[model samples]
Target: MANSTLLSRTRAERAAAERTTGEPVGQGRRIGSHLVLVLLAIYFVVPLWWLAVASTKTNAGLFGGAPLWFGSDFALGDNIATLFSYQGGIYWIWFRNSFVYAIAGGVGATVLSVLAGYGLAKYRFRGRGAFFALLLGSVMVPMTALVIPTFVLLSGMGLLNTMWAVILPSLLSPVGVYLVRVYAQDAVPEEVLDAGRVDGAGEIRLFFQVVLPLLRPAIVTVLLLTTVATWNNFFLPLAVLRDPNLLPVTVGVYNWQALSNAGAGGEQVWNLIVTGSFISVVPLVAAFLSLQKYWQGGLSLGSVR
Candidate 1:
């Protein structure tokens, strides 16, 4: 009887696997899916390709040439030179300021989200459900909507027009907290904590030594997201900072754009703006390429583990 039951279960498993992996898809359906993917890929890639070509083109080439066509006069090197040399090399300052804000704010936010999420997930405290609901509700609130109130509060605290104004506001990422809470609930097990307790481990030690390792993928996800968000942030910085030196790349690039569009001959060094924009994109692309493997591992972790 046992052998017969085992054989039936094995057959069922085999059938399920075959249905998922061995079934033949229709040729038309496969082609349609591929075509859709190709179209989407082109949609995203075209903008970056245009940016690259535009950066290498003279201002005349930008206005006169085919929008998607490569410019014959390669001015990429000249554009970069002008970009760095403009405004007493203040671009370097903006670049540094951006890194400082993004990294510090991202790390701070990631840590806070991780701790709050882990506590909420693992502990059954008073107002736990209500607090989490509030958090989720906050996620529905747009950042732009809160900008005015945030500015007011920051001004009251004398943080306006300062780097802290930007960094402090960015640290409250409801989405990161929500994502980490979900991850922590699934990645951490009560049995493991119990085992650590039995082995004479303190709660903090267990969290730091045992649970934190398992929660790495979620941590990375939150870190990457917060960092990118902070990096690309425009409105917050624009609202918070007044000094040109404290401006991030986004605002600095925007300043160049505003000047170029101000009047005729205003577009003389427009290629610098294009080149600077392209340069701003490089760090993000490099980050994505470097961390993509971790994302795959993160997504597969629960299933494989």
Candidate 2:
């Protein structure tokens, strides 16, 4: 009996040892994943690094220096002055236009998405499934493919070459709606809505005062995505806008890049282009850093969760 007891103890000890041995394999996988992430981070960051380095150089220094290295002289102040001063300070106009479009569009899309998503998730109604199917179908369709049709529609309405043309299109974020719907279905409980009704609260009041607070994370996520999309959107703007004054930084930068490459529009403007590129990304980075903490909250709670 003592031998049998010892044998059982030995098996238990072997099992414990095997468990301990397996833990390092998991740790090693984590380490490998971290290493891969670091590599990818570096890979993506290199161009930004080049943009930063190049922005501080003289037009001469840009061509002369090692591509990754800083120039002999730091000319960030001069470069920025040149960037803003170029062509009667058109860059500022583009910057303002981008801010207007991105903020307005982001907010508009978020509001629409949250409302539609919540209604779809919580309410039973006719054509709900079909509408959802249509929404999902829209997501699968590429935005680029619709650019031409959008331009044609805008042209028909006589909205071409206008700020409305950009802001209006940006507000139609199908993916945002889909994200909010999925999130709301999980986050906002029907029980809560029923409870609100028990207190004689109207649906609009419940949605605004209770449901919206719960949907903050999803709302912010959609807003950030829509903002970024509007900021970076190139093709639609290019197709719709003929006025250079209406250009966003994305298109304006492309304009500079084209001139730089073709040497068609006077002396090449590489330094200004690079400098402008560096400045434009700062807002996006700031936004990501600012909004990052909310993403960690659980969506199950229905509040910013």
Candidate 3:
């Protein structure tokens, strides 16, 4: 009886100790997670923070003082006015051109990718494997290495130095096709397609009304990637376009940077260039945030399946 009583007391003591320690253990884990997130936030925000600070400063302020600190004088308003008026308002032209290229190229690439990918995934025909192999091979080739060949081809077609030269190349994205094919194969089922066919739906109708809606998330992904690529594409634009008016924001920014370095555009223009870059980035950031929700929604829809 004494031994039984002692054992019961020990069990109760152990339970009490566990109850007291559990809350601290959970609190410690939460603190660790918060610390990790804080560090990650700092890592991502640091460059943007620096850019914002630098945009408001003169070149002297930029080159002098603490790198992270704001300048003594706020020249942001002046920078905006100068950027807008630079080169007879060429910067605004470049901004519009960027929008045209990004949106047009992105939409074209997404449509082509969806059609090509869905066809490749759902249909089987003679030489299908070979066709897919060609696509995979195209993706493997370095785009930079093909610039010269592309230029020559465009030259032969009398399309070099025109917007067509840039837009045409942007339209043919093997990587986008490949990504769509992979995603569609998993996300879109053959059974659903067969059901559409049984309902007397034609291929075009089925694609737009049925499969395309189902592949919204992948479509958004392709669109965003293609947009960013086209917007930031510098080498191709540099190689193909010599007209200052035809230049996109990336090349236009380079021109500004060059002028600033040569002291050709005056000292104040340096701050203008920095401020322009800061403004230019805003739209891209907005695009990502807007599309990100759609991406998440698509992922959830797929997960539910």
Candidate 4:
């Protein structure tokens, strides 16, 4: 009886100690997480903060004053008016061009990726593994390396300086294909495909109606990724398009900033350049924030399933 009582007391003491230790570990984890998140928040917000402050200043203030703080004179109104007036308001044209390329290319890439990935994942056919291997290899290749070759090809087709030059190449995204493939493979089960086959539904109908619905998260992820990538595609557009009218936001902003640096051409329009860059980012930011929830859910679903 004495031994039994001592054993119970020892067990109780051990349990109490474990509880005390676990509580600190949990608290420490939470604290660490919060600290990391705070750091990340600062990392993202700081540049935007600087951009906001810089956009308010004149060329003299931009060159002469502090980077992170506001200048003595706020030229936001004049900056916007000048930005809109530059080159007969061609900045608006660039903005529209970017939107068109991003949205249209994103949609095309997503559709192709979904179909290609779904076909690869759901079907067993000849050259399937080989095709997947080729796709994986393609994903490993850098897009920068393809620019010269893409330019040559587009030149051969006489498509350079046209929207098609950028749009056609942007449509092919190995990363999107890979993501969709992984998502479709897991989110869409073999049993489900078998059931669809057993039903009177055709493959296209089954994919469009059933499998596609299940892969909504992945679709959104691919769309967002493609849109952002296409929106930010500077090198491709730069290499292919010599026409200012065909220039996207990045190229257009670069030209404006370059011209602004040429002090001989009256006074440099620094405020417009800064404000234009700031405004150019608004759509991208909106798109990112809007799709972030879907993006997170996509990654979670892909990982879990």
> What is the lDDT of every predicted structure here?
0.83, 0.83, 0.79, 0.83
Ten contiguous residues with the weakest lDDT in model 1: 1-10
lDDT of 3 by residue, 99-215 (tens): 888888888887898889888888898888999999988887888897899999999999987888888888878877876776677667789989999999998899888898877
Give the per-residue lDDT digits (tens) of candidate 1, residues 1-305. 22223423544575587667566655455877789999999999999999988988877788887878877888888777776777887877888898999998999999999999999989999999999999989988888998888999999999988889999988998888877787777568889999999999998999899989988888987888789899999998988888898999999989888877786574556777788888889898987888788765454322321
lDDT of 4 by residue, 28-131 (tens): 45777789999999999999999888888887788887899998999878778777787798889999999999988999999999899888887889999999
State the local distance difference test value for candidate 4: 0.83
lDDT: worst 10-residue window of model 2: 296-305
Name model 3 segments beyond 4 Å from true.
1-27, 30-37, 59-67, 264-268, 296-305
Off by over 4 Å in 4: 1-40, 63-66, 262-264, 299-305
- For model 3, where is the 10-residue window of minimal lDDT? 1-10
TM-score of each: 0.85, 0.85, 0.82, 0.84
Model 2: which residue pairs collide?
214-302, 214-303
Q: What is the lDDT of candidate 1?
A: 0.83
Q: Model 4, residue 169: what's the lDDT?
A: 96
**Model 3: how far residue 121 lies from native, Å:** 0.6
**Candidate 2 residue-wise lDDT, 56-137, digit = tens:** 9988888896999997899999999987678998988999999998998889988899889988988999999999999989
Instruction: Identify the runs in model 2 with alpha carbons over 4 angstroms from their true place.
Output: 1-37, 295-305
Task: Quote the lDDT for 175 in model 4.
Answer: 81
lDDT of 1 at 282: 88
Q: Count the backbone clashes (under 3 Å) in each candidate.
A: 0, 2, 0, 0
- Work out how many backbone clashes candidate 4 has: 0
C-alpha lDDT of residue 232 in model 4 = 92
